[model samples]
Target: MVVIDINKKYPEIWEFLAEVPDPEIPIINLVELGVVRNVEKEGDKVIVTITPTYTGCPAKKLFEDLIREKLIEKGFEDVQIDTTLSPAWNTDWLSEATKAKMMADGISPPTDDNKVVTCPNCKSTNTKIISKFGSTPCQSFHSCNDCLEPFNYFKCHR
Candidate 1:
């Protein structure tokens, strides 16, 4: 295990992690997606705490592998990843900027109040869910009545 000066290496570590894209949603990195919970240095080892977006999210393993690969590539020999299930993830954890980006990318983020789903293409409230499940369990299929465009809505995890 190599001794690392945290003060000097912390920023670089975080920056690299921030650049690791989410497997399912390539557009947003793990940091912006709010899956990365905490980072700490313990005795020459780097420990990263992460929370899965959902209990059985298929991307969990890929996320861990990617994180490990990234840290190893960055010369962190002893890397520890801690998966925390407590205080399970919530859609509210997502940043406003990320939500906006999701909408812009043709995926409508869940409405906080569970109101009518909006169409990302036309910004219309006349949208109906075509299916409760979309490409993934965390998403649902919806179509805009006005624009006749189908889209995915990132379901809100309460």
Candidate 2:
């Protein structure tokens, strides 16, 4: 939470990053997706620290490029990106609001215990895991028994 709070310390920088959407999930911005870890301002330079959802995340380079581009587009010439794995990233970083937004978009967000991943299509708890891997590495495929709809569940990572 302390790292997230650093984002608030620089509202403008955070806002700039917020405009940069996730490369895969374009519906959600990087900030809301919990990819952006910290933001700091030093003189004429802006430092942004980000943590990948997972170490092997393929979108790592794209995330940095998008962030740098967005900041530069906002008139920031010196934008430094720092990748940190100190505390690491976890599903707990996602907020309730962000989860709701994901759910509304037909993607089940991760849960605390991950015991139940409701179907976003029908809001049914009667679901079963279809595959350990979904269309993406961070998600798992699932099917809703009631609605008979296939969906992806954002896997719980800690």
Candidate 3:
């Protein structure tokens, strides 16, 4: 439940690293998705802490490499990547703006745990879960009854 105000704490680094997009969802950046956690700069070394959306996430290695490459591309020499699973990444970490972006992209962002799924295409509550797993393990396949469009609902992970 402890969300770090990373933007303010590591303003320079965070702002620059915001360009690294999620491989699966190109519209969203990794930083705002809550995958990238803490950032520390010690001397010439920069440490980036991250938590995967899922423990066995397939993009885990890609995330580390992308972050390292981006840092190096930005003139960083010694970049250290660290993984932390203590607090666990959750959908709640996603900001309202992030959710909005997901919605705009035709992917339904997670809502309250008790609420029914909403169709991103037409904002309809009448939706059916097509599959527990969508294109990615973090999302679930759903079809909207009103729009008749199939979409992915970013699964709630906490």
* TM-scores vs. true structure, each candidate: 0.90, 0.94, 0.94
Q: What value of lDDT does candidate 3 attain over all alpha carbons?
A: 0.88
Residue-wise C-alpha lDDT for candidate 2, range 95-139, written one tens digit per residue: 889899889988899986679989999899999999999887789
The better candidate by lDDT, 1 or 3, is: 3
Query: Least lDDT summed over 10 consecutive residues: which range in candidate 3?
Result: 1-10
lDDT of 1 at 25: 82
Q: Could you give candidate 3's per-residue lDDT for residues 48-146 as a string of tens digits? A: 999999988899999999999998998999999999997878888899999999999999999887268989989999999989988987999999999
Q: Of the candidates shown, which would achieve the greatest lDDT relative to the real structure?
A: 3
Across 1-158, the per-residue lDDT of candidate 1 in tens digits comes to 11222243467788989889988888889977878877889987999988898778999999999999999998888999999886677787777899898988888987865577889999999988899889987899999999999999999877
Ranking by TM-score: 3, 2, 1
| TM-score winner between candidates 1 and 3 | 3
lDDT of candidate 1 vs native? 0.84
Candidate 1 regions exceeding 4 Å error are 1-9
Best by TM-score: 3
Candidate 2 RMSD computed on C-alpha atoms after optimal superposition onto the true structure: 1.7
Candidate 3 residues lying further than 4 Å off, grouped into runs, are: 1-7
